[model samples]
Target: MKILQIINSLDTGGAEKLILETIPLFNKRNVQTDLAVLNGFDYPFLKILKKLNCCSIFSLGNKSVYNPFLIFKIRPLLKNYDIVHVHIFPSLYWVALAKMLSFSKVKLVYTEHSTSNNRRKRFIFKILDKFIYSFYSKIITISPEVDTNIKAHLKYNNDKFVLVQNGINLDTIKNEKPISKKELLPNLENDSYILTQVSSFRYPKDQKTVIKSLKKLNDNVVLVLIGDGPLRNECEVLVEELNLSKRVFFLGIRMDVINILKASDIIILSSHHEGLSLSSVEGMASEKPFIASDAPGLGDIVRNAGILFPINDDSSLAKEISKLLENSEHYQETVTKCLKRANDYSIDKTITKEINLYKSLLEK
Candidate 1:
């Protein structure tokens, strides 16, 4: 089978990371995979993809999604593949046009990677989505919450939507050697509780609240903020303002997440919204006591395995962190449940479902 996965770019977001992870698994199944970027930029993940030696990556060389040139570039490309799987916004709209313009018979698939699309609530976009979404043969959502959110907008496209849980590759971190706290952050004392949040500094991700909560916790508690984005500078300013420069460490854009998660005492996801957080699952797979915000996508995943607090409540977050740090029994119970939850989202399960889906589509 030949499949082409298209997205905005090869950035370090959840959807981009999932595609990078999935393409290699497809190669192992004797399927050929390719990727096309609507708006091109050089990213660290491109190096990772080269090493994996799976997907043949291409770029349309357009800086903006609004560029009309994308249709011409994407149209001809679709003819070479049996399936074209698109992710993220703008790219979906572009491909919808390309599929029509090119007259390609290749099956089109889409995965709605967010719990909600903010534009869907607008009257104009609601009508536009109904037309654009008709191009796809299948539509996948990373979680049940994401599935429901998409259904609310594309009422007629409900039959095309499928719920596929985002999966983690357990074996990748299985034998990872954890870096010590002293190694991770210089001059950091022993016996410190590390509360880490692995997400880019973007909307819905409340890393500022995590930093604020650090002031409420004991002096020995340190907060680790991984990933970087536009809000990173603002988060850094807040850290300094709260006099938490020593207690909070910003490790920007890391590839050593497995080791980092392994070394941490606890994991937290303080997002205002999410679409089945892969970071939460990764932390859970590492057997850490995870805490997260009670938002749509995140709450759905962490309800059974991890602790959930009210959205943006730094004091509640602080109390939860303290409780986990103080009670060994509670921590141990959370660890056990986390491992079980992680198993449910294994890479094996996700790939099997995807392969079956592809086979079913081809048969039709």
Candidate 2:
């Protein structure tokens, strides 16, 4: 079967990374897969996708959101594939319109990657979203929270939505030697307790809370942020204002994130919200004790595996890190539990479920 995966951009994020990891699995099953991005950008993942023979990449040119020409550009391409799977927002708008305009017979599938979209609450968008979703053969939610969120807003049948938890490629992060502090950041002291958070600086991702927690933690602890975004400047200023220049390190957009995860003593995610965070799962798969905000998507993944602190509570976060740092047995137990939990969301299991879903829909 031929599948076309569409997204707004091929930039870095959980959805993009998950889709990239998933392409090879589809190919292994002798399924032809291709990717389409509304706007083009150079990213590390693009290089990885180029190496996969089973995949072909396409772009709708560097088009603006207002570009009415986009639908015409994508319409012809939709006919060649048996299924068109869309990820991320706005792509939904374009795909919904293209499917209508072209009268395409291809199966339309969508994965709602987030638990919340504020636009869903608006009345105009409510009508638009309902209409858009009606064209979808099935809606795959990355977590139960996402499923519940969609049902709350969109007028879709219960049978229309399917729960397919996001999974990670364990091999990508496993069995890597962690680069030492001296190698990456020489300013860090020999005894510094590494606390890492790998996420883009944006809303719902409260890196500020993590930054604040650093001031309360022991001086021996260092906070390493692994991704970059709009809120980065604000985060940088907060780090300076807290006088944590040496204590907090911002290593912006590194391709070698797994190695950074390997170097960390523990991983923490201080997010206001999430839908099964890839960073948390990757940390768990890296054999490190994962600490995360006790919010819906994150809580679901870290429940029996690692530690959780109340959202935006820096004291609670600091305490969890300190406790784990002080106790070797507790730390090891958490690590073991995390690895086990990570196994549940392996790429192999995710691929099997996805392929089965696609085949079942095609059979009908």
Candidate 3:
């Protein structure tokens, strides 16, 4: 069977990363998986996918990710695959509309990647979302929180919803050698501690909280922010205004994320909410003491295994980081728990479930 995974862009995000990691594995199973994007930008993930040369890549030939006119362009592409699996917004709506307009028999599958979004805040979007979601044969949720939230938002109960938490290739992370501390931060002392957060500066992500928390920590502690988005400039200004220009490093986007994660003393994810953050899982798999905000998607994964602070509470976050630093035994224990938890969500297991779901849908 042939499958086509559609998304807005191969930018720096969990959903985009999922597509990059899964496409090759799907093809290896002889499922003939491919990819299509609404916006064909020259992002770092797009470059990596091209280098892999594992599957065909299709672009809608538009720079803008959310052109309503994309529906017309996507309609024709729907006929070429047995299943068209979609991720993220605008692309989800566009592909659903495209399926309805073309009257294609191909099944449409959507992976809901977040527990919350702006669209859900408005009453009018509830109606619009229900209509759009009706077009899909199955909706895969990345976490239990995501599944429950989407069901409540739609106010519909049905068998179409499936729980399949996001996964990462653990072996890749384990095998990658950590970049030396000197190379990562030349100005800092060799014994200085590094706190890394690998997430795009988007609305759902709270890099500001992380930045504020850094002020509470000791001067020897440094913060490294990876990934980029519209809010990155605003974050830079905050770092400058807070006089943390020297302490905070904005690395933008880097392909060697696993290596950086390995080199860090602690991994952090201060997000407002998540639909099972792949970064959180990756941080855990990197064998670091993962610290995250006690938000829905994140809290569920991090509570017992890693560390969780009150949402947006920089003081509490600072205290948690201090605890890890002060107690070596506690730090090692947290790392052991996180590494064990990370093993539960292996990429191989997730892909097997996804492949079965696709096969089951087609059989019907």
TM-score of each: 0.97, 0.97, 0.98
Q: Candidate 3: misplaced stretches above 4 Å? A: none
lDDT of predicted model 3: 0.92
Clashes of 2: 0
1-364, model 3: which lDDT tens digit per residue?
9999999999889999999999999999999999999998878889899999999998887568778899998998888999999999999899988888899999999999999999999989888999999999999998989999999998767697999988999889989999988898889886689999999998889999999998999999999999898999999999999999988999999999999999999999998899989999999999899999999898889889999999989999999999999999999999999999999889998999999999999999
What are the clashing pairs of model 1?
none
Q: Candidate 1: RMSD over Cα atoms? A: 1.3
Query: Which residue ranges in model 2 land beyond 4 Å of their true spot?
Result: 63-68
Residue-wise C-alpha lDDT for candidate 2, range 278-353, written one tens digit per residue: 8889989887899999987899889988999999899999889889999999999999999999988888888888
Model 2 scores worst on lDDT over the 10 consecutive residues at 61-70
The lDDT values for all models are 0.87, 0.87, 0.92
Q: Residues 1-364, candidate 1: write the lDDT tens digits.
A: 8989999988788888888898898888888888998866777776688777777888898488678788898989988999998999889899989999888899999988898767877999988888999989999989988888888778864678888888878888677888887889877788788888899888988998888888888899998888989999999999888999988998998888889998999999899888878888888888789999999888878898889999989999999988888899999999999888888888788888888888899999
